[model samples]
Target: MATAVQKITLSSSRDIPFNKLVLSQSNVRRVKAGLSIEELAEDIARRTLLQSLNVRPVLDADGAETGMFEIPAGGRRYRALQLLVKQKRLAKTAPVPCVVRDPATDILAEDDSLAENVQRASLHPLDQFRAFEALREKGKSEEDIAAAFFTSVNVVKQRLRLASVSPALLDVYADDGMSLEQLMAFTVTADQGRQEQLWQAISDSWQKEPYQIRRMLTEKTVRASDRRAVFVGLDAYEAAGGGVLRDLFQSDDGGWLEDVALLDRLVAENLKTEAETIAAEGWKWIEVAIDFPYGHTRGLCELDGMAADLSAEEQGTIEALKAEYARLEADYDGADELPDEVDRRLGEIETALAAFDDRPVIYQPADIARAGVFVGIDAEGTLLVDRGYIRPEDEVPVAEPEQNSDGEPATVAVDGAQPSAAVVQRAVITIGGQVAEPEDEDDDAVKPLPDRLLTELTAERTLALRDKLAITPSVAFQAVLHKFCLDVFSRYSSYGTAMEISVRSASFPVQAQGLKDTPAAKAIDARHKTWEERLPKDRTDLWDWLTALTGDEQAALFAHCASFGVNALYEKGDRYGGGATPHTVEQRIADADRIASAVDLDMVEAGWRPTVESYLGRVPKRRILEAVREGAGKRAAQLIDHLKKGDMAKEAERLLAETGWLPEPLRMAGVDQTATVDATEPEGDREALPEFLAGDDEESPADDADEPHMIAAE
Candidate 1:
């Protein structure tokens, strides 16, 4: 059997009963209140309905059309139309357009209606919660509801949970911009009443307290075992007098109640009086002075007091006791035995000393006590104190003055004059290869001379010798100085230098038997070789080599040579060739000059001469010319131009010709060709030609081709 497809037409209100437009009371209120349906009604009246209503057709048992389709969605729109009819703006019997569908389609229609309302209308939290709950009542799960609206299940649940909050708290939250996290924390209390109570408390506290304090209070309230009671108590307390607690603690104002001013003054006066009383009785208790070494000085003081003011009989007994103690001390000087009677007396003395009460007469060292001195006491009734006195034997003594050979107080001498032994010892200087004589003529004369004079004299002598040797000239002053220093070193060789060199050269024995190869032994061997090579026979050519170095080069080479020792120069492969073979000092000097010239030119070519002069050292004229020649083609011209502007142009011209550039013409003109080009052109452009070679036309090829032209199409 085949089935026929029936075409169903959407019917207007004319084909259905108008009374069927009745909607839920909630929907009707929403429409009348200008909330849900007003905008839709205005849109429909201004512009024709852009969308048709979706409704499920309802039929009676006879299948006759008793009522029109009942709208699942568009309830608000349906209500708006009814309102328009009542206002006489729309026809009382006017037909409304709607799409009819099966009864089951009401679910989708309802969902679509909800989405439309949600998209167009801004619902309150309460309204959102109601919508979610209504959907839940239709047997929809939280996940289904969330998925239907493209939201998280948790969000849907939260909205539904908001239905449990009191309207007052919700309004407060909305007004204060309180975070949802804080509100959620407050809602931890399962009981709705308790949550409301906490919410109110938090709201009230937030208005009066600082943000931190309110946060603290909120945290405390939420975690509290009995939140409802805590919140209620807080609210009641705030209602009563607790609102002023913060002000009372922080501010000086005491409100309208007690005499805080008088109380404060009285309290201050009492504190002052109490301090005075404490100060007056500060020394009421005696503190014994004792130290670890002097275990109980207080006990000794007590013993002395016990012996003071005794009667004749007591005095005799103490004298007898002292005699016995002296005898015992003598006996125990070499022996460790003590007489029973002496021991008994000592015990009695110690006991009596411990029992003495001199609190009234006792005085404390005021400064020491104020500085907080501490004393130790033991259960044996021993008071340990520090008397704070240093014995003479424990002190370091000042040295005594020494007398002269004549056994008389001698005068100290200055400037190589004879001085007392005291002056000589104290001055601590060598004079004539012996201890210097101290001056007794004047105290100031006995004092040591300043180091500046010695430094000045030494520097003058050194500079004079340095100048004699021409150390800072072609020959490295450092090399010459090193050679001179080696001569000085030779004089001290027998004193231990030879022995030290020998010891350093000797190989270390392994396990005290055989020799071992080690760096120390190698160094020692190297030193021995150096020492041998530095001998007079080996040093014949040393001066010649030293004289070969330039002042700066000599300084650097000498410093490097000196690092290995003066003897190192004679050793094989020692930085300078062995002292046996002499390097041509003149040849080395000339070669160095040539090298320096080359380096200087390299530096100038690289634009580094100024930097080199600033760091390594200055270059001589020959080197400067060499540097100019190396960079002669372009940079030399620039240098010449720079020189021409200054007084050095004549000198520069000589240097340029020496470097092999076209100096004669440049010198005649007194201007550098490169400088002229640089000054006029600024930057050279090879692509640029003479003015005559430039085109006169300014219009571009495109502009010229803009005129119409017929062309054959291929």
Candidate 2:
């Protein structure tokens, strides 16, 4: 009633002489790939034959079996065995395990070879990882595994690391739910729970880039290249029992430091030790910190000191370095490029000469007794010791003249009616129509207005005068320009003009990382340097040099100096809680908008763009979505909104990069908005505006409702 199953005959197995197994032209493999023949031969010598070769009997064209066999499949294995014979590691007559096929079969050798190569499944990565881990658990060292498997120790370690990941994630990896690269990223952290959590979070998101995974895993950790970590050497941190997370798969820039608190402690201890050593040099005090705000020395006085003179031997070394440098330069005078060793030797000479030039400064004992040093680490992780800064309170007080009974200065008379040189000056002082010093008030006479009342009255008059001066554009500009010039050029003057205004370059204590290396910052620095080079070296000559400059030059210099005073950075609420209120902060931003509008400031043109480190990664998920919505449109925002904070931020960065969309603080008020609108509004969605943007309805409150108040403060 049923069709019978036909009985199939299996290929017979037997031992064959290595010398008799000949390569067949019907072999499917041609190009070289994994594991060279030499390495394979070495592997065979260690493990013997793991897989039996497939061999077909050699026929004599008469359809009869010959004494020898030809390999249709496992050609590489045959070659490896032959290589062992050639090396005398194996006997030519040594028996190799193989499956022998009949010479009378209808199957072609090529068909057998193709089927053997194509039908077989290569070992799964997960399986290999587990196998390596199993070997590791059995007391095999990473090196031993590598040696046995013909792989690198790093490869073995990577495989073991992969195996150590969360079993749940491992199942996903085995099912092809994640890429090998993504799995590799999870190895950055050893916490299996965290690995599983991250996988679960991004499992549904469309943005599971490896970098994003690595970022999420190591978000709380500090980069080993961070200044603090660099200062507290990685070796020292490890010695202190602090852990470090390294990414073997990617260039992690020395990887991340897992224990941030421990690192900070080590850095502090190291910094304090350095400060104490510097204190031994007779400095009055040492201010230690990880970093000081820019312009920290603004109000302080820097004492001038002479460099220590070179000793006889030091002087000879300097001459020798200089001579060697000159000889090398002359030897390669016009060569396209110097020889590698010659170039290196020249660099050494230059460095030696520079060391001689950067001699230790010799400060006077009196100066050292009053001045202090600022000890911190620079951006490059080098010890930064800014010495000889004299705080205002530490400056030597100038002796004051004797005051009369009525609090008036008693000027010594040089002659019958003239005052001494101390009292002789260009300007005469008057306060509220009275002399600089008022005569003693009399009880019988009507007392003059109180000093407080006089101050109030003069303040009102000062405001009125300012109003008038502001209307006179030419005079106002001249007055401000004159003040700037005097402040810049009259650093050493004992007396100054009556102007109360000053240009104080603002310092950013809290700024984004890499702010100093931004294009705008670099351009400003280059411009400042150019002007500094053009200016006179001596302060006394500054005024004369300015006077000689043409009108355009003067204006350019004025603008450059004024640019330094611009402060538009967003500060935290109540940064100056006691001194500045929220209203003042809001007004400051309003005024900055005016200035920005006047200059037509565009942050996008200044080379600012949304980057993870600069903005997206630092903000909350809701804010990131909001930024993406505004910059890259709603569709793009929705695309990544479901992602976790870390993944969303990275995707948003890619989406918003070219949109030229800026945050509220960076956008200038009164700037043309057509370009921004066109850039942000998706094509064909321009006319289909959102209700809020179209002014059709009131917008709902944001997830972070406090943002409005925070915005006002910023």
Candidate 3:
């Protein structure tokens, strides 16, 4: 049984005059928001009205329809049109599109207004990004797009960058799978493949922080502030066809240099050029490197050179700069802050004065003939040239008289008879270096046992003596103290000592960036400075100073000095199989372990956290997972095991940060490996993961082989 369908009719629409349309009191919108009336009016002027105004016929008190209508919805558009009219941009009688509802309709004007404002969905950011990209593709410059949208050019560029991300990642973003900040972080890098790869790695992780995303993206790149980059100069690097990655959203401190190898080459070339210029001074040799180990001048003789005299013109310039500096300082003497220009001028004056103060040193020709120079760049990116160092082998030889058996000086024969070839060879060898005297004729005597046998016997005796010394702490201490006393009290280091103890502070030529700023390094430096200030200024007074100290003070000083010689660093073996054999490496670690055990050294207590830059970031995903498993527990390891190498390392850094977990190399023998766990908690409870990590136990789907290698989820 079909009934006739009732037809529905929509309200009639018409172009109402701008003057005839009036604002209704029933309009719900009162507070101002979004674009201003002027901007909206400008937009309407740029591209006519986008939507029709909802209006109703105005009725008199007697129920008669008036000639005008009242707008309930689209009040903003009405105001915009009125503004245009006021500005004489649009006529008062302009035809404004409208939909007229019946004067007697049941719907209230407020209802219509509310419905119009609430029912319309705001555009998604992704849409805006895509729209901007589309505009750019349509032959519009970034400035054009910005002007069209009433935004800054930088904003337009950022949107474009976001749009340029991997389409797959964009899809994920469109699905509300990531935040705007995270999307912005991905724009730090432009490799579409890398963007997709990283997203897949962190998409399921619980710790997908925006900063983590940025760090992972730029981990392999060198920052512009890096010493190497600073030394090579970013402008010059770019001129050499190198690319730089910049972050437009946040301050990147000059961004990052994309081509690290190119930067290194430029740095090397510039350093070599500087070295060549310095070599013009007639140094016997110039040792050039990016950086030298600390205390590199040990055992080298340094020449005492005088600063070069300034030229007449230079002296006048220096005086002028100093006078200018004094005038500026007096002008701003008590001010809270100086004006930028004034401050800048003051800085220039000071620098000019410093140039005069740091005049080049003048060395004697004789010293220059035997001395060498060390050329490298300091941490501040300035060329550092250390001159007048004389190696021991380069020193002038002193003449000595050959004595006869009767204790009188022997004279050389003036006769033409030349010495035998063997005698000549011996004399030539003596000129090269100190040589062993000719062994007394012992061929007839059952020759002192074979040289090799004698060496073996002596080595055995040395081992037995060391074992005995180890048991007698007092004797060992006295022996070390005696060596130190001689070193300090004796004027010449050439004096011989029975104990082969020379406390040479180890230098870390190869180390992580910012190692000097670490807490451990800082504490050691402060301690060294304190001792340096307390020591006697003169070497001759050092013996008296030591004698006046208490026993405890002496022991403290001894320990401090001995600490400098501790060498626990691991260096790679030579590639050609020449140095640092596997056995030697093993032995070094073993000895370090023994020393660590004696001192009860806990690296965790030493403020060594597994940060991304220090440890995790440099290692593989496997090592990161292993660290997490050992430190945080198997559950925490599983949480991030699915992430890519970068994300995995970052997440591992977070999980293991306070756990006090250390790598095997940093762990001491016989120490509890899992001591990082909270001591008050029960042993069984330490494995419980953090609350944030407690989530659906179900494992996420694994990524393909292009992702980091994954362990099977438990």
Best by TM-score: 2
On residues 1-714, what C-alpha lDDT tens digit does candidate 3 reach at each position? Answer: 999999988999888888899999899999999998888888889999988999988999998988889988989999989988888989999999999998888989999999999998999999999999888888999999888778799999999999999999889889988888999999998999999998887786665688888887898799998877888888999999998888988999899898987987888788777777776665666787776644567678877788899889998888888888888999999999999999999888878787778878899865665678887766677787888898898777323447899998654321122322111100010111222223223121222222222222222222223333333345556656655776787673423233435665444444444444444555655777788879976789999999999987876676665555445444553557786554454444455454445445666665567876666755455556667877987667777865656567778888987888876555666555653333444656456655546544333323211222111000
Give, for candidate 2, the lowest lDDT window spanning 10 residues. 423-432
Candidate 3 deviant stretches above 4 angstroms: 30-32, 58-60, 64-69, 82-95, 168-189, 193-220, 247-256, 324-352, 380-382, 397-608, 611-650, 657-714
lDDT of 1 by residue, 436-468 (tens): 222212111112211222222222222222222
Error of 1 at 252 (Å): 41
- Clash pairs for candidate 3: none
Ranking 2 against 3 by TM-score, winner: 2
| Clashes, model 1 | 22
Candidate 2 stretches greater than 4 Å from native = 1-6, 91-93, 175-179, 197-209, 397-562, 565-626, 640-660, 668-701, 704-714
Model 1 regions more than 4 Å off: 1-120, 134-140, 147-150, 171-185, 191-193, 204-714
**Candidate that beats the other on lDDT, 1 or 2, i.e. the better one:** 2
Q: Which ten residues in a row have the lowest lDDT in candidate 3?
A: 422-431
Residue 627 accuracy (lDDT) in model 1: 31
